[model samples]
Target: MADRSFLQWPFFEDRHRELAKTLDAWCADHLSVDHADIDAACRKLVSDLGAAGWLQPTAGEVLDVRTLCLIRETLARHDGLADFSFAMQGLGTGAISLFGTPAQQDEWLPLTRAGKAISAFALTEPQSGSDVANSTMTATLDGDDYVLNGEKTWISNGGIADVYTLFARTGEGPGAKGLSAFVVPASLPGFEVVERLQVIAPHPLATLRFNDVRVPKSALLGAPGQGFKVAMATLDVFRTTVAAAALGFARRALDEALARVNERQVQGAPLFELQMVQGHIADMAMDVDAAALLVYRAAWTKDSGAARVSREAAMAKLYSTDQAQQVIDKAVQLHGGDGVKHGQKVEELYRDIRALRIYEGASDVQRVVIARQTMGAFLGGN
Candidate 1:
């Protein structure tokens, strides 16, 4: 069983514990594959996860950050594809959960929870990664519809998703005030997957183009000029979960390394018997524990009625993701040349963890967020 010690932290409740236990069992039963076909693997995982009722936590009435974190961490420990399938469901429907009308929720949430519809979030553009307010995609209102025109690149589940939570510039005002969020169905005319992106991990990432795509005004997520807020709010909830996913990867790497060192022999003794190897293991354990603290702390703070968790989430995402990269790298190093061998679990983990640091919010952007929040708390009327 996955460790339940972290769930004992004051950050969690019985529901969180229940979620962890349920998801742990589900993952053990479902995630028994090294499927090389990324898209097919993700599809099967999503359907299985949804049919197993593990996805209800993502689509729950209350936005339980703790449940989300626990589920992602557990799924990630078992299968990154499983984690991605669950996360994109939440992210793709987060606006609907937070701000969608009952009509919208009834329309999408059930489908998402049932795994009949795959979701994607389209925010990053070719020129706009961390700087979301600088997005150039236009969604001009035309009578009862909004005609979308522009591109969104690096979209998770882009080609495979049945729908997307899209952000576009709907006004001429400067900065984020002019942007709006929309729930654009993939079946709409003029909405097309421009190109499929091949990444190190090989998921269904793509560049999307909306060439005069017209969506009903009802597709608007919140309100016009609130896209930035909605997006940030959604990220605030999801970012810590990203850290949780990283934590899972780190834990798996540690497990892999531990098994290797305990059995792999070297210089008249097992690797674990060597002082240097022992030190490496110690560091790995320390990093994993530290990451768990930050991750759970962020989730707890958010679930405790904090309006926003920018600082805490940034700290968690930044530290956990970066530390996971380090932990996985160390694991690779510990495995000697076998670590670098293609198709090795450690090698795949090394590649998987690298993108976590760069996406959601890059580590550099997270640092800026942390420093600014620190300064604001210290300087704003204090």
Candidate 2:
């Protein structure tokens, strides 16, 4: 079993511990199924998670970051796709939860929490990745509605979501300040799924196009010019959860490596008896623990009433994800040829962990965020 000792840390409360236990049991019981049909599997997984009431944390008032982190970590330890499904539910609806009007929340949150609806976050465009300020999607005001005309690629749940919390340029200024957020339903007049994206480890991803799709002014999330702030706040909450997911992957890799070394015999002795193998195990253990510390520290900071946690969250994501790649690599190395073989857990993990480093904010982008935040703090006192 993966380590449960992390729950004992002061960073967590009794409710957090209970949530972790419940989710671990739920995932073990419900997540065992063939994932060859990635789309079908994702749909079913989201429905099952919703039916079980696990998606409640993704919506509603009072989002507890600690609970979110614990859920992602527990789910990730069992299934990466399960983790993805759960994370997307929260991420896709985060804007609504944080800034939606009463009617908007009522219209969507219940169905979303019940798994009857899928949600997506439409932010990245064809021309923009991490550069949110450069987004070119336009939402032109026309009386009581805004007509959207642009394409969003690299969108999670792009082809299948029921509604998208979309960001578009609304002319507050030249950069991020000009951006605005809207909740656009998939059934809108001119919205289209341009392409279904395939990656190393598949989940539902796609490119979406909006052609004169009109949404009522009621669909606006927060004030017109507050979209950038809304997006940043949403990211700050979810970024630490990404680190927790990485910690889960690293822990599972360590467990696999440990089991392999004990079972495999070499030179008339077990592989665990070798000094070099022992060193690898030690390094894996340290990396897992260190990653856990940073992940929870960031989560705890957020839960303890920080308006934003860019520096803490960035460090957690950057270190935990980068270290997880290292830990998984070591696990694959320990397995020798079996590691790279198709259908192997370590092999799947190798693919699953890769995108975590790239998404949310890439590791390189996170370093820059950290450096800027650190310097801002140091220089602000003067």
Candidate 3:
């Protein structure tokens, strides 16, 4: 089993501990699924997670970052797809929960939290992945409605999501100041899923084309020129949870490696008895603990009323994801032939952990963010 001792750290409270225990029990009972039809699997997982009330934190007014991290970590330990299902629900509706009007919240949050409707975040474009300031999607205001025309690629829950929190250029100025956030429904005319993306690890992803989709003025989220701030704020909250998920994958790899080594024999002795094997285990253990410490430190900082955790969150994500890749690779090395087998847990983990480093924010992009934040703080003298 994955270790639970980390939950005892002072970073968490009694309620956080209780949340971890409950979600762990629920995931054990319900997380196993056939991922053959990935779209259907994601839909079902979202419904199951919502029905269990585990998704409430995603849409609630005051998000508990620690609770969100605990849930992602636990679900990820059980199934990566389960963790994906939960994360998308939160990300898809994060804008609404954090900055939507009361009317918008009433309409979407309940349905999204209940899993009656799916949600997606459509911020990345073909040209812009980490560079939000370079987005080219256009949302032109015409009378009381905004006419949206552009394509959003690599959108999670693209075709399946009932609604999307979309970002587009709404003004003439250059860079981030010209952007705006909007809530667009999938059913709107001219909005279509043009392609379903296939990846090494299957999930519901697609390219969305917005022809002349018109959304009422009420669909705008926050202010017309503040999309960048809205997006950054939302990322600051969820980025650390990505580290938590990586931590889960690493922990599971360690657990599988431990089990394999204890059972497998080498010349009448258990494989784990070998000094080489012990050394590998030691490295894996140290990396896992270190990643856990950084991940929870970021989570606790956000939960403690810090306005933005840009630096802490970036460091947590960069360190945990990069280290998890190493930990998983070592686990695979320890597994010998079985590690590369298609159905092996370590094999799946190798695939799952790769995308964590590249998505949300890539490891390289995170490094830039960390450097900028550090230099800015040092220059500001506080």
Candidate 4:
């Protein structure tokens, strides 16, 4: 109903089309969980998604970017929190999926994939949200263990996560070079959720503290000085999915707008009868299609064996997120005062879309990445 035509694009295979159809049906039935208890809702969503086998693609050694994008887009269309839960599962354990030792992967991927355990990615510090080089969290090597002492804020699934992929300074050098990644369990003696952060959309976010929490050397994800590489590699795989999620929100917003325009009467006719309203609808549809193209282009480029689609992914995320904000704004304006009211789909979407533009590299950050990549590409005579 919401344009399955995109699935037929050359970017996707038959299996991907089947996946979209099957998951859309499942979401319509199962994703309507009560959000009165937000954390509980997210937990149940994860369990349901995992039990349904929708989470299988997340833990595979060789990830398919197209499949990840497709799943996120579908889940986000139905419910944003469902998207959040699934994305966190992949993101929190991404380093393990990509670079963990066989034993490390064996121990955690099963539980996370099965939804028996939740995971968090601990990268951002209070003082270093966008500046990874400024991270001050220390993980000192002491014999067979690394003593972790630091804080991570704005962590998704913070209080509820059973495990965390933590990044800390290990003194290999300075700034980003010295950072190392580790697999940290929440059950460690010094790991604590210092404060639960309440954001506009109300997901389970918190600030985590580690006071001399010592983990075995085996907890390291990659080489001692490879945390920055591990984190960047993981992000390269997941960033495009963020754009897909934004596309989903925009698609839903378009659907809501269309329904409202056709049914809501004004001045003795349907609201869409006005030429001005028709212009808004046209702009919204064009934005949706444009965003979809960029989103899938990045996914396709990655799946086609590009080593790193950082430039493509950044472009997709930047364009799709910014356009989605504009598209959703048109939907909100078309709905009149009803759009601003609590519990409205448009209102919820307004909040949900805002964070996408800010997180996983902000819109401004993406621009910088794109510009630098473009400049380097040109200078290389390619």
Task: List the global CA lDDT of all models.
Answer: 0.90, 0.93, 0.93, 0.93
What TM-score quantifies how close candidate 3 is to the native fold? Answer: 0.99
lDDT of 4 by residue, 52-89 (tens): 88888888688888999999999989999999999999
Model 2 lDDT per residue over 1-382, tens place:
7888989999988988998888888887898857989878888988999999999999888888888988898888899999999999999998899999999999999999999899999999888899999999999999999999999999998888999999999998889899999999999999999999999988899999999999999999999988899999999999999999999899999999999999999998999999999999999999999999999999889888998899999999999999999999999999999999999999999999999998889999999999999999999988
Residue 174, candidate 1: how far off, in angstroms?
1.2
Clashes of 2: 0
| TM-score for each of the candidates | 0.97, 0.99, 0.99, 0.99
Among all windows of ten consecutive residues in candidate 3, which has the lowest summed lDDT?
A: 59-68
Worst 10 residues of 1 by lDDT: 1-10
lDDT of 1 by residue, 39-144 (tens): 8888888888888887786765579898899889988898888888999999989878997878889999999998889999999999989999899999999999
Worst 10-residue lDDT window for candidate 4 reads: 52-61
Over 4 Å off, model 2: none
Q: For residue 297, what is the lDDT in candidate 4?
A: 95
- Model 2 lDDT at residue 158: 87
